[model samples]
Target: MQDKINRWLLDNALAHHPDQQALLNDNEAIQAASACQGNDAEKLAVFADHLKVSSQLIAVIDDYRRCFDMARIVFWLVAFLVGASSAFALLTATANHVNLMSVTLFCALLPMFSLCLWLGVSLLRFGQSDSISGGMLGRLVNAATHLLSKLMIAANTAPSVHQNAVFRAGRQWVNPWQLSLLTHSSWLFFSLGALLGTLFRLSFYQYDFYWGSTLLDSQQIAVFVQISFALPAALAGIPLNADLIASAQLDQSSIQTDRAVWAQLLLMSIVVYGIVPRLAFIALSQVKLRQSLKNLPDNYAYPLFRQALKRIKSLSEQSQQPMLAPRYPLPADRAAHTGANTIASIGIELDQSDRWPLIKEDTVKDLGHLINSQQYQSALTALESLEKPVDVLAFCSYARSPDNTTLKRLRNIQDIAEGRVLIVLCEQAIAESHQVDIHSRLIDWQTRAHEHALALVDFDCSHKVNVNDVLNAAEREQQT
Candidate 1:
């Protein structure tokens, strides 16, 4: 969890945000830290006392956790679904051999060989990051992250530009080692399944296993066997004699040999080559992941943390009192006038079910994704066609944190609309919801919305609204 937090703070966009910028100064962080005067636990309490540090840190951690949880779920699902299928298919093919009386060592070991080849290629390509980005595994991971973001969203619509960028950027930084752990875990399940399948059949069925191969000398086959099984066979007190090699031919009844040696070699080969190495890689990846977390630089060096401290100090000093709550900007009253132009009720991360306020015969637009070209174009076209100074009422989900993404998106709307735009936050209607305190989450939204001088409102559960208030606010903005 701590490692994920470290990774989240590394996102480049955070540096571009005002909140993050304010948190970037070393001097400010040091000044904020001066309040701490005890052990680690007490120090953490002191750090929490500073407003910017806690909020920025929580947001980063939350962002990373959203994707991490999704990736991990996809990884385990692959382990069982892909692993079981591969093992079952190969094991069935092996068991269905018509000439079970003369099973060649190479034929029995084909599954392991293919598995090794796949791991080799994946590792090689893992080094070239872009090469794998569009590959099967990468696509699976991307889909998982996408789905994760969707499931976590309070609204069913696609996320904002900054939100999409955040997850897309995360894909590039998730280390190959972490992905390798997922691959190795799947391999372990696959190899064990195949080995167990073979063992199960062998225990119940009677069959003589001998070595055979076409286009290769029996002596050469024997030599290959010696190289592969020499150590395991030796450990098990088994020998590959020259006479045994000459006698071991393709299904010749007179050249029959004990099948026990072949079974030992096959089982040992599966254990030593397939299962052992994968387990080792999984362990190694774990160590590397933890080390990466520990190696993350201190928060004071981070721009986001620095900006957080800065925000806190500024708020305290400006008010001429200690900071109490997040400073918010209340909407200012504007000169009232009768309506003239269209009212565009754009939904920001909102689903279809959420109601938007109806303005007297005004244009209404529904956009699922703020950054996507199609949705953006549709909304822009509507605004362009409408008379100047359109009133854009944006309905957003109250469940999600009004992070930098929401701020940038709404600000962008303000840029293009050339009129009044109000953000209406809808309540969480779905049950079995998140445990985060509603008011606490609202604080984040209020702070961000206030930062941009945007109009904001929370949806009443009844979806009831004063028609006059809605119309008045729509008509209040000073025309550009």
Candidate 2:
């Protein structure tokens, strides 16, 4: 977990360098120290000590990945099944020694090859960025069209109430008619091919069997053989005819005279309307879903932390005493310019400090308003503006001094702030030596934040209350 956190943080730090260097530097040092502890238990102990870092964002990421993984699994399963069916057909035809076997082989190979290439390209395209907006839009349109088409077909096929009742009552539980259709089509093609082959062999060998002599002459037998082959060909023409009608409907002028024009048209329609669209929809949906997950707000922490900081600041202000003094005073040279600001500079200061002297009541009220209005961006902005190290620490430790939710909010704030504030808070938390449970949560949060380059706050709040001890006690009670 520490390793994962380190990697996540380092990646983020490198990506957003100078602005995030201070936070990254502090975390790297702490992570190195944690790494020195050899045992898994000791490492886990360190993680437990700071688990409150960013639990919610991590949870959300995990959940999104799980859903995406499931979708990929299902899509791959379907693709595999289709590929297998095509392979089986190709193998069977090759072994049969049947005429037109070459045509069968071509039919089986083409779709499978095309689909594999499409899938490979789709995966490569989606990996580049998180916001697959175009893909999502395409998927939505396709899914909507597919659903509408199905509804239209159902509407067209609907029977009258009396007819519907009769049909429903006569229906086989497993749709035996569908099975019959499959069997009939398969047997028709295979049987016709076998019959034609046998007749061809008899004619070539000059066999003079009893039925051959009585039922038909050589010319008649040749005609019978032609008809046997023609039957399968004619039956196969249904799909070709359907394709011609569909193509004509799409664009009548695109149809041209070719020897196998109907077959070409049919194959084109199947590729465009049936196979290509289905695969495109799946790929589009996956891309869209991934983008949505990536773009989901990590601002959940901001509002809560902002509120906590405001409250603490308000209490301190109301007391007419600074609860905590600035550790480092402003430089003497800068202090001399206390009254040297121009009118333009005054305006700038006011604009910059718009939310300063943070009042808890007002901050909470604003958070409530944002939540009520669903103004997530505004809320995030407001929360991120609370930059004081002590304020951040107070906010994180307001309730139980390291609640999971609070830790998660801090992590998110860290992501947005992309500054040293997160690291400062982590150090403060570790120094306080509060409850062990709090320390443990904070450690975990720090570890994760470090990995994600979100900034880690180390608070050793476990002197009095061992987080593991409390958890073990709770577990014992639960078991009982």
Candidate 3:
């Protein structure tokens, strides 16, 4: 879907004609091009071909996407650095002990505690999942992208709106939660670093391993060990014997101990408890991230697609017709020397208060009667009853795309009216957000009129009419 939207964007960018470009942005155009045609995959392909969007544009967009992914990866690595550094600071070597309990408590169990807290929070029904970048990491990534965009814009001598738009799109598609897939990866790296640091110290110095508590005895400590490392310790073939527990007691008078066995237990506990499960969770997050990236947000639906769709559907229907359009009887000459006043302005189902013809000059005349598409047959009957030939100024709302029924109704007006017919496309003052590519509605009417040979194409409602253009055409008709 993103590809289709971007392709349509490229087609609009490459089009030299402003109207065609605007049409490409039209929601009607997009729907016609992509939807109401074929199955999902086929629809996008046909839409792409219809627009003739350059493959180069897709490649450029893909390249930018790859760069964004790289930025996210870098964010993960930086976050891992923070975690690794924190692990080192908290688990630094303590006073010499017969037991390495201090290192295990800080490096191994501490991370497990943090991981449990994180998991518990994540499982709650929050409105949205928080990204790893929800904190300082987010700020850093935003700052980085901002700098990159500024640098690219500043480096270019000539401003290309397409290029700027593409850059802006890159910023738009960057999903922060998508990068949280690396959360477990960062924790894994931190745990591995802590383990490596412990090993490095153990190689240089021998520290005995034992357990001691003010309330707990050796028998209780042995029971706890068996429960905690039950499956993994058993799978690793480490025997959980009474002698091993007694040897591991800190207050015991007997100093005899199998140091190798005790070290293996602590090391295996970190691998089983800290690293492996985290790696699995990271994989799950990656799967979820991929799915999230594939889905576009609802607001992405184009607003102008209805008009473009109407144009495409109309064109298709016209092609299937035996005659492109029904022929009308040869009409009489247009009302001689007709001005805006002589021309009766008719609003098609427009509101009584609609400020249409927006400007009512003394040169123009208006009946101010709003006729709907369904009431067109009646309007035609009334036109036929007019005393003399007078031009009919027809109004069309730009807010709605011109449809087939509209074309048929216009034909009805032309067939009955003796004078020239003109279509005045009406629209409210467009907002800045909608200013881009909004001329498609006007062009759609013009194209439809040209196709069926019904009415004159006047300027869109937003603009002041060049009355001289109308007068000149009328004068030519009078001369003929």
Candidate 4:
């Protein structure tokens, strides 16, 4: 997963170059990659391995990876320390007295507020396609990573313009949800650090806890304390009564001062308010981030990646085709000069049981079937030995499209014939249901014939072919 992202990022960076062919379209490399059996990501990984990505761009990617990892570590470490220091500073009481309201608010205030904001943003942005922006914490982490990446680049004495541009693009590909995941994890660490900090302060130090209020009486303060600390106190098994609350007031001198109950209430408050919510959001952020990564390629807006995918598909199709033997060239110098008007008939790749057209000429020579290389060579040899300017009739089935091998064979026959060659599309065996397919095949043959400057004459075995009439039709089609 780590290197896959890097390779894709590098490929995208290379695609933006003006000379794409020189940079990316290496024929042998493409063929090699296409030969591998796998999905797009696996094949693209092979392709990237074959291509020579620039060393500077490679360095930039490596640098980004290092900086991102380091920034994650540094961010969490800073968050933990900040949490610990804030807890330690607030818990340091003045004149051996701890204010209950100030202690509760200091531990719960920032984490609760930020958590509410995160929950609101998450609900509003759920299932949205945009990954460019995230919540406040996510934005802060992204900014920090970006700054660190720049510093890493600056430390290098000379960075290429190409590397700089690719760096900018690669950084933009960062998913905001991934940053949000990091943000949630950092908060989790902060909560853990605050918990440990609170335990350490309360375990080692002794202080009297009290509340002083100018506007409210002790009864009102008791009511407020009961309402606020009800859940935490219940979970901690600490009894909260009006007598205990009134005795903890500053004006009322208390002979009973066991601060253990107050410490338990504070720890429970930090856990319930700070730790558990961050943990839940961290899980939610992780799930969203994974989904975003899984759908990354599909959501890529660049045409170049799509083009590269298409190119891979085309190359794979080409690679899967069966290898074919080389086509033999036509016999050169087979022209005859005896001046006897003759007709030579040959069927290419046709069933031997199928009858050839009955030609009304004494000089007609049936050169058997030209199905394989040996048969083709023998027919060409016989035609070379002819003693007249012989016109050729080449027969092919109209049941299927003319493939490259079939076209090549026709071209070979045309080259060696003395007078002229006419393609006879034998359609007598075709059924009426395949008439539409036959018409399409005929159109394809006509286009191929036009390309090679050959002529065509439809042949039916039921009809007798007049040598002169067929010759005339072939000549007319060739001229047109």
Candidate 5:
């Protein structure tokens, strides 16, 4: 399950790249994988394997898991040590009798109170379990993990790959329920350590136990003690009666009472109250965590997966039909036209097999394909160098899905053009049979562009690039 989740995270991170297949140099592998029949995950697995950075990404995830597991072990060990020391301090042989009330407060009452508080918080905020850490202990662990992550990043320990994927995966691994499980396990260890410490101390030395309260009488104390000891006594078969309680009262009698009963009661209280409840909560956390992980959502609508599915469907259609030449040539220079809108044209992630519907070389300056950050930066530099703002034509293939990166790229172009940019969707590269798919993709892009108030137009390669559509769209915006 962890491996599957790691793979999903890696895919999502990689999909954010401007052109992952081209940037990773896995175009051939991706093409082959698209032609094969498989689920999205299997295809993504193939895509992951073909990438140059996948190995380093996997190594980073593995390293994070190791560090996380080690941190948990250390926390449990520290908790056990603290519990042992606390028990030893409380039970030390002293001149005054060890207060049975104090022992009960530390070993049973306090722990029970804390447990109930955690349960209440969890139940109240059950709908937002992921947003909430379990309690103070859960927050402490998260804070520690966050601090460690920052240190690693500052030191550049894991270089040349996306560090967020590593840390994000770590965060998901230690989600709220996972933290709860760890907390419960740590408490269980603490209880066991305290029990062991008590047993060792009792074996080495003898201590008297007595209870006292200014507001309560011997009868009242006896009744409270009997109620408290009911479960422990029933479980362990330890004899508890009003006479034994009356003898141990500090004000009623100073006569040394049965020390064995008090010791046995203390140990049984730790086991019945502290250890048992922690174990039950740990099991519950485990079950809930499993259910959450198993139902983890996969966004099939994500642009990368959408593109892969489209390719599979497109290729399957092509295999069934006879091949024919496209109606229009790949590259055809547009006839000379004079307009302010014809300042420049740039192709974005154009298909290798098809060509851009070109403008005359001297009429419009051409910025090459915006496939990676370097190319995008170069295009931005060229646009910024212009003496005056002009209507720039940004062309992209209609065959591909328009993701957030694509929108961002268009937005940057629009900024440089000072609201005069026109997006041209190249449709000559697509087949006649895919008209429905092409229209669907076009509507998706149009909706996004309209929402962001960007001018966009679509044209086949057979026709000259349309600059009139931008003017018309702008007029529509003004009228509205």
Candidate 6:
């Protein structure tokens, strides 16, 4: 089922380019067999645990997609209704011997005019998720930042091809919501406005007015009649009609009056049903996220050496326990230190006895090699070996990345591990986090793991940062 869904996503994404066909095919296969799957209690327990994480990630992506589609549909429907109402007023006025120019002007101008205004407002107000910039500046800034980061990472790394692969992967997994918002919002504004304009023109021909004699004289009832019907039409029509000045002499007073009332009602409905509800949802989501972050354990101030000692003890205990033996045990007496040249071959240095020094270039290169080789066991071993608490980073091509595997590994470590784990990621690679709903799910995991002594390190590398300065600062602080 998961493979099918992934393939479907690939198929849709790749419809315009046949070159991606092989990449998608490979992804489907990797996702099928990479994670653990079994019926044994421990294995089941582990699988179920990872499955929950996978499910959360999938749900977030699905929900965002669902919202995108829904927003599009609603915008179109509203625009159509508005246009139809405008047309109805125009036709009714015309049937009552209203000026042909006035009727034509109102029908043509009203829908088009209002649509432009609405589109402007929507474009200004709506934003893509994870976008640092809100409008034109944001799109430009984001693109520039991404390109620069990719170029820098490529320039600094050896094996240029591998670096390129990582950069592409990072781009793919990083901005799912951002892309969705941009595409869906644009579609909603244009398509819906067009539909609404057409509907209003059609409605104009459907409604007409009727009159009856009354006891009140024309002079006595003139004010009342104008106020009752013409006021609304005037309100709804004036903002929409470009030629309102030229048609001022026509008796469109009744139609204008009706339109004003309908427009007011529509505004009220939107305020009540749309704007308010969305605001409430945003507030609620923020509150929940805040509470979750606050509840995370404060492991920052703890002495790094002491924490390493504690981790060693915990790992030792778990390894000896019959029911909880290490899934993949390490060599009993592995060397704690390696020469600079041998570092990549030895992988991550997890032994607490030997202080793990921060080596930026060595770690990054080794990680890239491990990931490319599909040596997850070696990668896990390497990650576990790290003594220093610096953030770990990885990249995968969007079209041919091990994003799901990386996500699963992170989830498992967060869930079962006993110490702080911080994963710093580039902006281009952050889309998977949104797609997997990492924020909410991580919060939930943190909540559940509170009693088990776990802490999460937030490496929010997606934000703009001075990479060299950040690494230097971390190194200086580690030395302290």
Clashes of each: 7, 37, 18, 0, 0, 35
| Best-matching candidate per TM-score | 5
Q: Taking the tens digit of each residue's C-alpha lDDT, what string does model 6 give over 1-480?
A: 434333232222222222333333332222222222432222222222232223333333343334334544554455455545654454455454333233333433333343345347546656843322222322433454455544444434234433333333334432423333332333333334433443454345333322222454443334433433343344345342323322232334543324333333233332332333334433543454344334433222224213323333343343345441112111222111212212221112121213222234443324433333456566656655655332343222222232444455644543322223323222324434223323323333334323333222223343334335444443342333
User: lDDT of each model, Cα atoms only?
Assistant: 0.53, 0.32, 0.54, 0.67, 0.66, 0.35
lDDT of 2 by residue, 1-480 (tens): 434433232222222222222322233223322433354334333332233322322332233334333443443444444444443343344342222223322333244344445456556666564212233222333344334433433434322322222222212111222222222222223323332333344234322111122445545544543433243344455333333323322124343333243333223333332344444444555454444434433321233323333333333343354332212222232211112221000000111133332222322212212112244456556655544221121112211223334445545543453332222232243333332333333545445444434323223332322323322332342233
Cα misplacement distance, residue 322 of candidate 5 (Å): 9.7
* Local accuracy of candidate 5 as per-residue lDDT tens digits, 1-480: 777667655665555544545534343344445545787667656656555566666666665555566667777888788778878888874444787777777766666777888888877777874743466765676666666656555555555346675665556556788778877888888888788887888788788888777787878888888988789888989778777888888875365668888889988998888899999988989898888777655634557656755665555566456653222111111211225443777777866424553554465666666778898889888887764555677776775666778888877776776535566777544523333244445666677766555566666544454445534543443334
RMSD of 2: 22.9
Score residue 204 of candidate 1 by CA lDDT: 68
- What TM-score, to 2 decimals, does candidate 3 have? 0.47
Q: Residues 1-480, candidate 4, lDDT per residue (tens digit)?
A: 787577656766665644566545553345445666888767765665555445666777777778778878887898888788877877785756877777677676567767877767767777877632366656677777778878887776434655665666566567777767777778777877788888898889887888766887777888878877888888888888877777788777563486888888888988887888878877877787777666665312355445666777775674456533222221233222123556788877754335654566656787767668898889889988885566677777765456667777667766666565667777545522333234334656777765665567565654556766666654454344
Task: Give me the overall lDDT of model 4.
Answer: 0.67
Best-matching candidate per lDDT:
4
- Candidate 3's C-alpha runs over 4 A off are 1-64, 75-99, 126-180, 195-207, 210-232, 241-257, 290-295, 298-300, 315-480
Total backbone collisions, model 4: 0
RMSD of each: 12.8, 22.9, 13.9, 16.0, 12.8, 21.1
Please list the residue runs of candidate 4 whose C-alpha ends up more than 4 Å from where it truly belongs after superposition: 1-4, 11-19, 39-41, 54-56, 123-133, 155-173, 213-220, 299-302, 309-480
Residue 436 in model 2: lDDT: 30
For model 1 the local lDDT of residue 332 reads 53
Q: Model 3 misses residue 270 by how many Å?
A: 2.0
Against the true structure, candidate 6 reaches a TM-score of 0.23
Per residue, candidate 1 scores C-alpha lDDT tens digits across 15-66 of 4344433434332233334434454334323444343444443453465567
Question: Residue 219 of model 6: what lDDT?
Answer: 38
RMSD of candidate 3 to true structure, Å: 13.9
